[model samples]
Target chain A: MLSGEGPIFLQLAQRVAEDIINGTYAEDAGIPSTHDFAIFYRMSPITSAKGITMLVDQGVLYKKRGIGMFVAPGAREHLLAERRAAFRQQHVAPLLHEAELLGIDRDELADMIKEKDPS
Target chain B: MTTAIDIRGVSRRFGRVTALDDVSIAMPEHSLVGLLGRNGAGKTTLMSIIAGQDRASEGRIAVLGHTPFEHGPTLRQIIYVRDNQRYPDDYRLHHVLRIAPAFAPNWDADVADELVDGLRIPAKTPLKKLSRGQLSSVAIVLGLASRAPVTLLDEPYLGLDVTARSLFHTILLREIAAQPRTIVLSTHLIEESASLLDRVVILDHGKVVVDDETEAARDSVVLLSGNTDAVDRVLSGRPVLESHTMGAMTSVTAAGAADDSLRALADELGVQVARATLQDLVSAHGAETPEPLELKKAIRV
Candidate 1:
């Protein structure tokens, strides 16, 4: 599961975030252990841990003493907020610029969205 | 930066075989250093001596301002993570984590927790039951999370796949950036890790063949490829490491210049000049020359 050309830890962090969004790991569920991830992915544990540590630093997961890591409370909300902000910066502005070039107004976009799903 | 490791005329030997021959080098603090060589080229021997796992037959080694051997406080500050870490049969993944903090002074619990969770290491699985890749991962976690001032990782990514190795490199850079420390990495996979290293220390046979800043080391050698006659003309009077020829085409590795004169000479001879890689430089050192008597004498002192 490779993505962009950045560090492996960032890719892993994205994958774990995806897993959280997709409900693969339910709210408050414990994440996999470092050794299992290493064996399953055939990666060095340190590399896998780099991803997990990223999530912890971002407050997406919290460690339980001597137990393991669990998805933090309100993690999905936090992720959604982050995604919304990222979407505005990475997609919305670019889309607006493209739309301006194509002469597609906000009303046209709204109509297109409505046509795709009336509900 | 202060010197984290200061090796002065250090030498190690096993009976008639000389592993290190009076090699002296100083490792600056908070930089990623690459220790490079072919198999049996005294790389591991030198690392072992600095880590205090093996004693040098001669010379002096100081890690963090103290002699490494049996110096508990100094030894604790240096973590040597290798492919062959010994664990008892009954030991499990949790066992190592449980005891790592005692030795690693700067050990970060949060980093350890994240790593354990990310790797998905089954806490209950015994060390013997884990696969080779898993074992390598365990070592990586300890090495990184330990946060020792002088972290020595010798081929820590041997069994890992490309993705895993990439992840390791990324984490290493980020961690080192966040908490600067003196790191010594010994690996045959030089090209992949080349960019991460601030400097390169190359050992040939039992001596320091090339020790220089990464940029300087890369710039010291020039590769010229063209017609055999043309390459030979340009290579004449220069120290040639190795050469290969196919049909009318020949490539020669030589130590000389990246100067305009050399570039113009290569152009005149229809030879293409390229910077030599660290791997090429190591290979060109001629597979470690036979240890000289002088080096042996220096080691004894």
Candidate 2:
């Protein structure tokens, strides 16, 4: 599941964020601990901790002190809002730029998007 | 942070050859540092000096707060597990594992038993009769169970396959999570164990070259490719480590990230940008080679 796009920890952090959005990790529910992640992924505890810490730092996960980390309240909504903006800027914007390079106008791009829709 | 192993200006010589030269690095408490390099690049010498197996010809070496070489208390707290661990002529796995507690005060027999069951190391098999993989597993068991305050694993997986190696990584993390300790693991498998390292210290020609957090090391170098002119124009002033070209395509591994303007230019020029993995960073520095002529200089004239 990890790619060489950057450090494994960052990739793992992004993967966990994706999981949260996909409803695999429900809001206010405890995710796996760092030790469990290390064993499951065959990664070091340090790496796993870095990934989980990233989520905690981003407010995607919250610590309950004596207990472990739980998905923060409104985590899914927060992540989805960020992901939607990211999709627009990263994917759709790039696609439009490429289309522009190929001499396709905004209308043509819109038409192409509509044609590709199954419904 | 408390320094677990403090090495300063250390150098080692064997006969007329210098194995390590003027090296200094401190490993903090409860860290997993990777010592990476090619074979015969003085990785063994540097680790041996830190483990107190060999004395440094110049400079000081300390484990915890005391010198390691020939020091009883300091040596006992450090476990040095080598890939080619030797045993007495007829020593069986059970006989060796039974005697492990004498050196390490923190030895855990239960952990040893658990590792034996997981790695499937035959307890009664004679050391000589064990296959290469099984022999390596014995070393792995000792390393995890010893629970030494300072543990140095010098490429402990020699004959292990992928499944066995994965077990080592999993078991190591599990044990480290239970009890925190300083670990300096030297390995030829750079990327394979990259994710396990807190920091990576790469050696070439008996010297520490790249020693940084696993994050910074990979991020410091950027890999770029496209037209030769475009690649050179974009990363002109940056330190180019590895460069290759075929026809019009040129690939260059350079230091530092490209700024916004540089990225825009690269995009305009069709230059593709990529990030370097830990392995790419290590391989870009190239390998180490000993000088035959300088061999005589290591000896006292």
Candidate 3:
């Protein structure tokens, strides 16, 4: 599932971040070790470590000297806030561009988004 | 990290054929390096030289700072199993299992047993009678179970089934975590094994075409596709690896990073752009070149 266009390490970091945002890992909950990540992802240990390190650098994950890595306190809120800031450019803009190409007006797009059940 | 294996201007010749030509690569210790190339691209020749099984015609190789050829101490710390490994005429799986430990000082018998069972190798069958996939399984058993500090695997996935391949990967990663060691694996299954590599060294026509960290290599090229004229304009002044022209559309693998200006031009010209994958890079380097693996500036990654 991690196989994407960009570097494997970045993809891995994004996946973990998505999981945190979804509550798969709660605050102070320990994530899998680097070795476990490598085996599960079929990636090298070094790559797995790099991905984990990136999260640590971003303040999303924190390391315990002898134990393992755990989700940083307030990491989910931090990631949600960050993603919300970029949601316009990453999701809404291209979406708007496509809607424009399809001749869907702004009002019609708003209506389309408001409709919950499209039977 | 200190260098585990170092090759300096290593060249190998067989009669009139030049198998390796002044190749040099310094592999960092405890890293998993993917040795990739097309068939007969001198990958095997280079592996053999590093294993001390074959000597270079010109240049030298140092493993752990000691010349490997005919050096018993150094050889003991390294394990190299060829793709087409051969056993005695009457040898069987048990025979190999019993004798391998004598050579590999750091061998782990439990790892061997786990692999043999995981791969479902026939223990009673004669060595010569095993099928290609079975032979590959046996080679993997030796390669990983040996636990050598410097392990060289030449085409370990030659004939492995999907299940067996998955098992091999799991076992390899587990072993590396338990015992950090330098491993250089050569294989043609680029995408399947790309993630398992920390670094990648691509060879074509006996020369180092692309050598860089796997993450860096993946970001070193960009793919552009659109109308022929538009793509041609954006691709101008770029070293193209592979290009396809179908009717009015053209798709190309352009070497080097795609700068903002280039991306802007491509966006304006309706040319879609994406980062090149590892498979794309290897195939691009393998593609016929004007000067046989040219694009020297593109190798920095």
Chain B TM, every candidate: 0.92, 0.91, 0.95
lDDT of 2 by residue, B205-299 (tens): 78877878888888778889998777777876787777766666778778786567878878888999887888888877663222221222333
Give per-residue lDDT, candidate 2, residue B144: 85
What level of docking quality does candidate 1 show? incorrect
Top lDDT hit:
3
Please report the candidate that would top TM-score against the real structure. Answer: 3
lDDT of each: 0.78, 0.83, 0.90
Candidate achieving higher DockQ, 1 or 2: 2
Better of 2 and 3 by DockQ: 3
Listed per model, the TM-scores of chain A against the true chain A are 0.84, 0.92, 0.92
Clashes of each: 14, 0, 0
For candidate 1, write residues B86-182 as lDDT tens digits. 8976999878988999888898887777666666566888988887777877878898899888999988777776766776776666566557678
Which residue pairs in candidate 2 have backbone atoms (N, alpha carbon, C) closer than 3 angstroms, thus clashing? none
lDDT of 3 by residue, B200-260 (tens): 9999889998788998887788899998778878877788877766667777887888899
lDDT of 2 at B143: 87
lDDT of 1 at B278: 71
Those runs of model 2 whose alpha carbons end farther than 4 Å from true positions after fitting are A116-119, B287-301
For candidate 2, write residues A18-90 as lDDT tens digits.
Answer: 9999999999999999888877765667788989999999999999998998999999999999999899999
